[model samples]
Target: MPYLNAAAVKAQDSPGIISVGVLLLFILIALQILNVLRKILMWWIRLLWWVTVGAVLVLFASIIYQRGPEKTVEDALRGARHLSEVWWREYRRWEGYQNLQQQHHVGTSQKSWTSRW
Candidate 1:
């Protein structure tokens, strides 16, 4: 019963519309400050912008964590990892084939020149 109550509380408190509005408001203010700071500080502003971008990305990720379906996120990450590994293996194989082709071309060219002489 306690666990059920806790789950109910969590479900009820989840961000609906107001929290999203507040998040957007903070983001807008942060962007405006970043623009002004960049104009005043130049390179420092660029560094700040990168930091801001990192923070924003993290915030967006957290928002997704809070809002999105847990199972879907898990499945997506698993699929993404699988795809990346498959792609890397394929890329390495391609590179190996390319190197072999290059070697074959060089060896053939050398043999042809030797035969001509």
Candidate 2:
């Protein structure tokens, strides 16, 4: 077997090393994008949650103002339960729409990369 000198070894390994480096860079970039997108979505979710709670509190305050505190507690409790059920159902419906859109899109290649592995 022939020995690989330093220059010969470097030449032999350069393409593979470069390819790996490029692949790593690509993956790192993809991860960064995903992280940013995740943060943005989380921000939106938080904002929506706060807004929903704030709106409910305002509505409750209005109800208390209009009807007084005596009979409002039971009504508020029932409304809260119904509101939670409706909120989750609507959220799931919206999520299903997004999933449907994702599933129906046509693709040339590697479209299901996340699921492929």
Candidate 3:
């Protein structure tokens, strides 16, 4: 299957090993290129992550500065904590809804099976 030209593979005068050597070289070069591309992707991804985190920090700092004198670092932390709590509650609500939907489906399927019998 590797030799597309059947006559060339079977020929007595042609150098068949040269084709295999070239294929091997091509695969090696392709692997090296892929490795370099992967490294470049990783570098860019890391740089992007740093930039995002830095931007968030700057925004958070600015918000804190804009708040009245009554607001402190603890207030910011508390807000973050409250946000996490709200997200947790929302996740639980979604999970419960999914469970209810699955149960309803199962119940209907069971009813259909009983009716068929």
Candidate 4:
């Protein structure tokens, strides 16, 4: 019955309460460390994402360069000039053919009219 007094009860319970407080403090420290680790992990994930994006961009650019119409501005200009020249040559040839056909048709028509008369 003496141990049941208020002072004895308080003294007896103090050790358990102090131990619980210490345990809670350790848990708080552990949670803080976990939070820091989570932040670091997120940062690394973000960095990796950017690196992957950069790599994809490089790959896309290389593919486009490889498969594009012309490699450089100079090449494009040269291609355009060649195309224009070919077009002009074809146009002149077509015009010459048309002119020769007109001349042949006129000559035959005149001979036919003379022979008919």
Candidate 5:
């Protein structure tokens, strides 16, 4: 009338069942710990990358600040304007000198030709 024999059920070991349950619990705990460690490692890598990018940006800005000609925009513009005016004056002087030289040469050549004739 019963599906299981009472004597056989009583003979089955209980300690083996408990040991299997404990083993599976430990395996699950280990998997959870590994997952947490993987997430932590990914977070650490991202933090390091951002820090490196910040350092590079700071270095570039410092170099530009140190090497720039003028500290202020107004000073830079004024200096550039002064330099352009000086260059323009020098160019006009050079052009006038060139014209005088050409005129002197033409006059000298005309006199030489008339004397030879």
Candidate 6:
């Protein structure tokens, strides 16, 4: 009978099998990309979550541990002013020392000393 032709049946089914295999390969690639994206998103979320937690902990602890708002602000202001003054003094000293070195030509490069002479 016409339906009993096994070779014809096998040939007809081969194309369908090939198409299914190709579709499966495409699905596998899509799944791999999806997994990679999920991992990256999870890592980023974890980093942000920890950073936020640390910041909140620091802020809350400072507020609870400090004596009062006025003390905190005053201390901060005082520290800032002291730091500014120290930096300014240090800068002036550094500039003055540099000027002295320039005048005396102490510890200068050979080329610069020769040029100066």
Best by lDDT: 2
RMSD of each: 27.2, 16.3, 8.3, 24.2, 23.1, 9.0
What lDDT score belongs to each candidate, Candidate 1 first? 0.84, 0.86, 0.84, 0.84, 0.81, 0.85
- Between prediction 1 and prediction 6, the one with superior TM-score is 6
lDDT of 4 by residue, 1-117 (tens): 775687567857688876787899999999999999999999999999999999999976886688684555566678899999999999999999999887997877555455676
Question: Estimated TM-score per prediction?
Answer: 0.35, 0.54, 0.53, 0.48, 0.41, 0.45
When 1 and 5 are scored with TM-score, the better candidate is 5
Worst lDDT 10-window in candidate 6: 105-114
Best by TM-score: 2
Lowest lDDT sum, 10 consecutive residues, model 4, at 108-117
The TM-score, computed over Cα atoms with residue i paired to residue i, of candidate 2 is: 0.54
Return the clash pairs for model 2, or none.
none
**Per-residue lDDT of candidate 1, residues 1-117 (tens digit):** 999998668767885655777789999999999998878789787899999999999986886787687865787789999999999999999999999987997877555455676
Q: Least lDDT summed over 10 consecutive residues: which range in candidate 5?
A: 1-10
Superposed on all Cα atoms, model 6 deviates from the true structure by an RMSD in Å of 9.0
User: Given candidate 6, what's the lDDT at residue 100?
Assistant: 86
Candidate 6 residue-wise lDDT, 18-76, digit = tens? 67878999999999999999999999999999999999999967875775777777877
Could you tell me how far off, in angstroms, the CA of residue 88 lies in candidate 3 after the best superposition? 8.5
| Per-residue C-alpha lDDT of model 2 across residues 60-81, encoded as one tens digit per residue | 8998999989779878789899
Number of backbone-clashing residue pairs for each candidate, in the order shown: 0, 0, 0, 0, 0, 0
Query: Model 3 over residues 10-63: C-alpha lDDT tens digits?
Result: 654566777886899999999999999999999999999999999999887787
Greater-TM-score candidate between 4 and 5: 4
Query: lDDT score of model 5?
Result: 0.81
